[model samples]
Target: MPRKVLVAYGTKNGSTAQIAQIVAEVLSKAGLTAEALPARSVTSVSSYDAVVVGSGLYAGRWHKDARRFVRRHRRSLAPRPIWLFSSGPLDASASERDIPPVPGVRRVMDNLEVTEHVTFGGCLEEGAEGRIARMIVRSGKGGDFRDFTAIEAWAAHIAEELAGPESR
Candidate 1:
């Protein structure tokens, strides 16, 4: 049977959703059945072999829905291979080390034995901002800073890992 994977994300302004779609595509290419869904829509993951969850970081914290999903499904997710990612940091120069997941998020990582948590550069498009975001933009803190190549490479690596000895 084909391995099934779930790519769930919580996005603000849609960039993280695009990232999740790319991840699901990469997993599909690796011969795994994968689907990308918003965290809010996913009620259960018992049917999947693995799960990848991501969220847009806000002020160094994950989106509330993503956090809640992890909390709610912790038991169901514990037995599966799980990967976590955070999409944040509007600066192009931001590195993974510079954007570690928040403390609350880190707790889940430890509980799940997640080896690593990736932090990707974020995109903030014009006219997609709220009042505070607009104010930050006026201070020169906005643009499309996502590194697609990095995201793709990471997804491909996940696919390879999930593929196991047969694919290698």
Candidate 2:
């Protein structure tokens, strides 16, 4: 049976959710059973063999839901293979270079046995919520900076790690 992987994310404007979906798709294509869901919607992590948790970076902190999810499920999550991701850089900096996890995320990593963590570029389109998001969009600084190629590659690496050498 294929390993069941859950890709859970906390997103305010939906871009981070899109990234998580891409991750799940890549894992599924790599022969694992993967599902992506909003982090707040997940009631339990015990059913998944591995978990990928991601959150939108806001003010250098993870979204509240992501933080709560981790704290709520820490016990169930600690023994499982885990990966993490953050999406929120309004520029090409993320694609051009590695962006370390924000401090809050780093603390979470320190508490958990995270196998890997990645930061991807963010997206802010016309319909984004919040005053600052609207202001950024109006100023034309908000656009999609997500590198799908890089996102896919990262997910594939996770799959290969979870699926064993035979998967390669």
Candidate 3:
């Protein structure tokens, strides 16, 4: 049987949520069963074969709900194939390697033993953009800077990895 991958995320506005949906769509196109759902909509992960968690970064940390979800489900998630991502570092020419990890990500990295962790350039928009975006825009750093190709490639890689022998 094919594995069921859950792509869940927390977003202040909707950028991060949109990213998660894109990831799920890419993964599904690769022949996997993938669902992109908001963090709050996910109750029990018992049926998932793997998990992809994402959140927007603010104040040098992930959104509070993202952290809380991970903390609440750590034990249940530890044994699975888990991946993490943070949306941060507003519109810029910064390289992927240059995108800094959110503050609490260090502990999450250590604790979850996450299979993968990535950072994407954040977008700055008003009329509902979160605190982080407001700050970045106010500081003259807000813009849409995400690389869709890189994002799709990474999702494909995850799908390939999940199709391997061990994931079964």
Q: Evaluated with lDDT, which candidate comes out highest?
A: 2
In the order shown, the candidates' Cα RMSDs to the true structure are 2.5, 2.2, 2.1
Task: Report the lDDT tens digits of candidate 2 across residue range 1-168.
Answer: 339999999999999999999999999998899999999999999889899999999889999999999999999989888899999999999999989999999898999968889999999999999999999999999999999999999999998888775321
Candidate 3 backbone collisions, by pair: none
- Pairs in clash, predicted candidate 1: none
Task: Give the winner by TM-score: 1 or 2.
Answer: 2
For model 2, the stretches where C-alpha displacement exceeds 4 angstroms are 165-168
Ordered by lDDT, highest first, the candidates read 2, 1, 3
Ranking by TM-score: 2, 1, 3
Model 3 has an lDDT value of 0.81
lDDT of 3 by residue, 96-157 (tens): 47564666987887898888888888766765555645776777667777777778888988
Candidate 3 displacement at residue 93 in angstroms: 5.0
lDDT for 114 in candidate 2 is 89
Candidate 1 per-residue lDDT over residues 1-168, each given as its tens digit: 339999999987899999999999988988889999999999999999889999988887888889989988999988888889988888875444556677978999999877467888888777765787777677778888888888888898888777776321
Q: Is candidate 1 or candidate 2 better by lDDT?
A: 2
